[model samples]
Target: MDIHTLDLNFLTDEAIASFVVESSDGPVLVETGPHSTLKNLERGLSDLGYGLEDIKHVLLTHIHFDHAGAAWALAQKGAKVYVHPFGYKHLLAPSKLYNSAKRIYGDQMERLWGLMEGIAEENLISVEDGTEIIVGDATFIGWHTPGHASHHIAWQLGDLVFAGDVAGCKIKQGPVVPPCPPPDINIEDWHASIDRILGLKPSRILLTHFGEVSEVETHFNELKEILQDWAAWMKVPFEQGRDPRDVTPEFQAYANGQLKAKGLSEKEVARYDAANPAWMSVAGLMRYWKKKLGA
Candidate 1:
């Protein structure tokens, strides 16, 4: 089996990535990116000598638009869509998910995500922890790893782990950055989830936000450290009773400084920000602290 990274080219180059695992049985796609990039995904599949219709299985880490938005489209074409059980309802009827994202993105929703159509129930496979998903001769073990999103799962195939966001985001020439999107960011759960990933002892991690990461132990260590730092940074603002918007600039500045110290150019910082917004991390971590304090 060979894994290929399909650059979704969302907003910028190398910002978002989806993986295509080529197997003798058929081609399997992991992460559909956003529906807006379906054309790019099709083109990528074509490059691999496969077509959209040739994709027999579609495995998703989560149902976030950027990750699994195109699963419905593929499912419509007879591809089976596998997702975390908690996310099954949303994919079955994505109105709530679509509407919720609309509130966040406003006018840019459709342009950014295209539109999320519902995946038929027959085509939807709700997976749980320890679920083994077999794609032809290839075998993938799905483990429920939350904190990024309750519906998140990290798929393990041989030595490779499709870590989704549990392993954090690492763009080229930058350090690992935690992706703390809102409504489901739990620091405790995230730590435990990271431990779960470490237990796997994977040689390579495939991130949906970007591409492959080979420094397994170092990557996990950095992700844990940054997760702590970001959470701690948000705790201060939360203790002062400051709104997330009020501290976003400060957090962004701090993060920018840290990234600069690591030798990332301004353009690289901007590209990283484009893939994973700093503001969302602030809000998500603030919410996590509030929940921890029983507020």
Candidate 2:
């Protein structure tokens, strides 16, 4: 019933995080950052007097590189990975996903993601919404909370929820920002997912991008408002047929301005973008608007 946060130190300090749930059965890992940070994850586990081999269950919020890149590697060590059913195929044979990411990252692929391999099908446990997984004395329930990605799931245990990107990303004592990555961003679905999380009435939420959020209501309300505002702002650019690249700077400025007003230092603002790039939001929001227009 104890949770530990692992700062992956991905690209910047406190950018990406993984959670470890210590149970009587074994250690359960939630969100494996990227494969590039696997060594740091190992070090984190070691710090807790455990090792990678000690992990028995790996629960992923989704298969996005930042969240599940190290999942296959952990599975290789005999851990059973639990993920949304929609992502099972990709993990079973990740070549297509790798190629797709390579197309975007190109030269930075290896440095950003490390080695991504296909996980054995037998090692994967496809979970549905409302699925309950019991590990030792703890109970974890999976809620299919799509919006950030169709495969996204927020796991709940007691009054705590492991809300990956569905609850948005907020650095400690900083403004919360929605993680709108492209190719599958759905604003409507995201809104519903946010509502679903709220219905859970969780007292605390743990985010994969950073750490725990104790002010659950305020955090989620602000996240929903900001998410809608960003999407609404991008709608205009998309309607005018403005290139995403051209509008990215404007979006970045607006987001940075908000962070600055929140008393975040320049370095802290940089870490926010490093955690969830503003450009990806531009591209993602544009895609969402375009899809709505039937373009």
Candidate 3:
């Protein structure tokens, strides 16, 4: 299976990615990025001598805008969208999902995510955990790996796992950081998900945040470490009951400082921010800590 990564060219380069995997049946799309970069996705497919209509199967790692926002568009083009069973209703209707995102993104909603429409029920294939989906010679398994989002799934294609946010976000040589977005940030579940990914013994992992991640074991170890570190860091502010608006900037600076400590330049650091905004993490982790504390 030949895998190709398409740079969505999201806010900055190397921020978001969509992957095209070759199978005996045809081209299978892993992540669709956000519809805001749909043209870029089309161009990437065209460059590879295929078109959007040629994609018969689209496997989404999750329903996040960055990972699966453009899925409805592809489904409109007649692609069978493979997603977690928990995410089926939202993708089919999408009104509630779109409105929720509208609340988070507000005025920048269209600019960041574009218009997200609903996919036909027929085009939406909700897969059960550990379900094997055979598409020609390629057998893709959907692993329900939550923690990032309750509806998340890590699509396993042989030894390569298309890990969405569960694998966290890493750009270039930057440090791997967990993207704790609202409504679904489970530290315990995330740790378990990490263990599950490692259980697969993937030779390599593909991150939707950017591209391929080698050094699977080491990367995951680092990810687990950072996940704990960030959660601990958030615990302080959460206990203090500090307003998130006050903590977001501080956390952002702290995160950027970590990136700079790694010798990443301003642009690289900014790319990390673009990929995983600090404010969202602040809110997400705060909510997680609050719930854990039974607050």
Cα RMSD to native, each candidate?
1.0, 1.0, 0.9
Q: In angstroms, how far off is 203's CA in candidate 1?
A: 1.2
What are the lDDT scores of the predictions, listed in order? 0.89, 0.92, 0.92
Q: Give one digit per residue, the lDDT tens place, for model 2 in 1-295.
A: 7889999988877788999999999899999989999999999999999989888899999999999999999999999999999999999999999999999899999999997999998899999889999999779999999999999999998999999999899887788899998888998999899899989999999988789888888998899899999999998899899988999999999999988998999988988888778889998889988888866
Cα-lDDT of candidate 1 = 0.89
Residue runs of model 2 more than 4 Å from their true location after superposition: none
Return the lDDT, model 2, position 150.
90
- Residue-level lDDT of model 3, residues 157-226, one tens digit each, is 8888998889999888778999999988999999999999999999999988768898999999999998
lDDT of 1 by residue, 1-295 (tens): 7889999898888878999998778888999999999999999999999888998799999999989989999998899999999999999999999999999999999899999889989999999799998877899999999989998999999989999989888887589999888888997888899899889989999988788888888988898898988888888889999878879989999988889999999999888778778889887888888888956
TM-score of 2: 0.98
Predicted structure 3, TM vs. truth: 0.98
Scored by lDDT, model 2 comes in at 0.92
Worst 10 residues of 3 by lDDT: 267-276
lDDT of 3: 0.92
TM-score of each: 0.98, 0.98, 0.98
